[model samples]
Each structure stands twice: as C-alpha cells, then as structure tokens.
Target: SFDVGGKEAPKVQLTKDGKEVKFTSVEGTRHVYSIAEVKPEHQGVYKLTAKNKTSSEETTVTLNVTGMYIIQ
Candidate 1:
C-alpha cells in the first residue's frame, strides 16, 4: 500500500500490454500507481508502481503462472 496527497500524487492507472485496469476511482494515474493485469500473455518482468498526486515508484517483478499439461 502507498500514501499520497490528494492533489499531489498521480491518480495511477494499471494495465496489461495496453489494456486498461482501473485500480482507483481517481484520475491521472500515470507513473504513480502500480497497476497491471497478469495474464497468459504477461510472461516476463512487469512494472509495479504506486502513485498519488505527490510521488510515485518504479519497480519490476516477474510473473509466473503454472499451467496444466495437455496430454495427447
């Protein structure tokens, strides 16, 4: 979790490969909020952030989701 001023930090927006995933009811969620939707296509280092109207963070994370084997 993060704390930011109401009019300081960015409203923060999350997405996966350009898909919008709203994390908050606020707007201007740019490099502020840590937002992303993990999907089968999302296999690699992802960006994680948290922002408000004040300040934001920039980080990276690896997403690993196992899948069932498909037998012939």
Candidate 2:
C-alpha cells in the first residue's frame, strides 16, 4: 500500500520494463494495485506512479524470479 499524502486521491499507474502493466484492485481501495499472477515474463523492474493535478510521486521495485529444483 502507498500513501499519497493529500486530501484528494492521486491517480496511480504501474509499469514493468518500461511497458504498461494491467492491474486491478483487490477491493475498492486506492492503495492496492493487484496483479493476478506472477510469471517468468513478469520479472523486471516495476514502477508505480501517483499523480494529482498539482504534483506527482514515483516509486520503483525489482522482481527477480528464480528456479528451484529438488535433488534426488
């Protein structure tokens, strides 16, 4: 969840690897950005932006997917 810190809610968007990613809210809340599933293709840098008429703020995160094997 992210805090926009204002009386009015900010518009939010998410992008992965410089491309726009589709997201949904788990509930009817502005703080949640939900991706239905995670796959190998989903591994990349993700950016979240919150903007209003007056100002904007951004945050970024990296997702790395690794394989795990069971040894016999």
Q: Give RMSD to native, each candidate.
A: 6.3, 2.5
Tell me the spans in candidate 2 whose CA falls farther than 4 Å from its real position. 1-5, 26-29, 34-37
lDDT of 1 at 4: 30
TM-score of model 2 (CA atoms): 0.73
> What lDDT tens digits, residue by residue, belong to model 2 across residues 1-72?
544556676777888899987665523444565556767877899898878888898999999988778999
lDDT scores of the candidates, listed in order: 0.51, 0.74
Q: What is the TM-score of each candidate against the true structure?
A: 0.36, 0.73
Per-residue lDDT over 1-72 for candidate 1, one digit per residue giving the tens place of the 0 to 100 score: 333345564444455444554444443332333336645665655454557655776555566766769999
Residue 23 lDDT (model 2): 63
Clashing pairs in 2: none
Top candidate by lDDT: 2
Top candidate on TM-score is 2
